[model samples]
Target: MTARADHLVGVLGGMGPAATADFYARLIQHTPASRDQEHLRVVIWADPTVPDRVSAVLEGTDGPYPAMLAGARRLCELGVTVAAMPCNTAHVFLPRLVADTGLPFVDMIEETVGALTRAGTAPRAVGLLGTRGIVHSRLYQDRLRAAGIRPVEPGPEVQAEVDAAIRAVKRGELATAGDHAVAAVRRLAGGTVDAVVLACTELPVALRDSDRAGLPLLVDPTEQLAVAVVTTCLGAEAHRAG
Candidate 1:
């Protein structure tokens, strides 16, 4: 019998260093294996130096594309079977990265929406909490609309606070960041939205476990991406082992 090949998953991270670490943690948490060898192999190229994605997309400035491409290329060179990136804002330039690297990337945005559908929790409207660039880019808006869910965004005043929360996470201020995130969630919840999406990687860091219990359920793109990464890679490993 021809044996299936073991698959390796590559992560292009470090849009924000803290977010990258959190993504790895979530990946570990979601894996079904109990032993070290039973886990999926992951190669992480964490380049916190990747220029800010928000500024690049909005201000017409040089963004993290080149750095991200370099990381993707390195993973390709290492023979990773599939690639995933943790940052939502970085996804704005994903097409460029895919064209440059020729690697199959697991789409975090698509996966998140799919997750909601599979969970049977398709809400009429989902509140979005992320960087201004993601909102202005309309990345999530169009997708959510297609999924039969309206995308509700924070008002300018609340978005400013959301931005502050993201920045605080980057600065390693978890407590203050959590407060900001909770405030943003409260505002979005007030609109009678069913759920909130922590569309930005940094936003997830701002939310504590206890805080998540109180707030409306958050649809986490990072966690969604992690789940996809684990499922795909481990499924491949199982086929190979068999």
Candidate 2:
């Protein structure tokens, strides 16, 4: 039987519980549906027990890939139309998940950079904020560069603050996390970047409403990812219905 719209979206999440919730919330907000039935059907496999993604990248261990693969496999078994993972750092293992599941995985980084280009919000340079793994991996750097947008990185001290902010959010210290995040953004913006990307999913939760009175434009990759998820799922659903 074909996968129905009522069971279209498979979420490979739980790199952190809060980020997973935020992604789903954003998906709801982005979807065009106004009622329960109109909304895209979503099934989330939130395995908070998965290994830490940063530790895996930084310390050279298996990390969360195996657990993530298991979740993706289950979703595919259930015949989800497409899958997405909200955690930016978790994307370090996305290729493996896709290979194991043999399913189409939405590329959050690609979607994010594409949003910047298509939105015409950041015509020049863009600033990045995320964990040390995200920066060290250079995940979005080459992609942003190839798109003709310069990627500006925060200095060591400011990056330390970014790292601290990510950790604070993981600890559920949203207030402290917001302060560090705002401070880092202000520093990165001072260097003349046209926009700042909250490349890390946790940042959206941390700085959801923190003041950004005079900083450059802020781009949330999570939001971009959500848009991609909604569009892909809903468009496919419409096609199947027709």
Q: Estimate the TM-score of every prediction.
A: 0.92, 0.91
Native-vs-model 1 lDDT? 0.84
Per-residue lDDT over 89-199 for candidate 1, one digit per residue giving the tens place of the 0 to 100 score: 888888878887789899999999887777766899899999988888898999999989899988987798899999999999999998998888888888878889999
Global CA lDDT of candidate 2, please? 0.83
Segments in model 1 whose C-alpha atoms lie over 4 Å from true places = 1-5, 236-242
Q: What number of clashing residue pairs does each candidate have, in the order they appear?
A: 0, 0
> Across residues 86-178, which tens digit of lDDT does each residue of candidate 2 receive?
988877787777777787788999899998889845469999888877776788898899999999987998898888888898899999999
Against the true structure, whose lDDT is highest?
A: 1
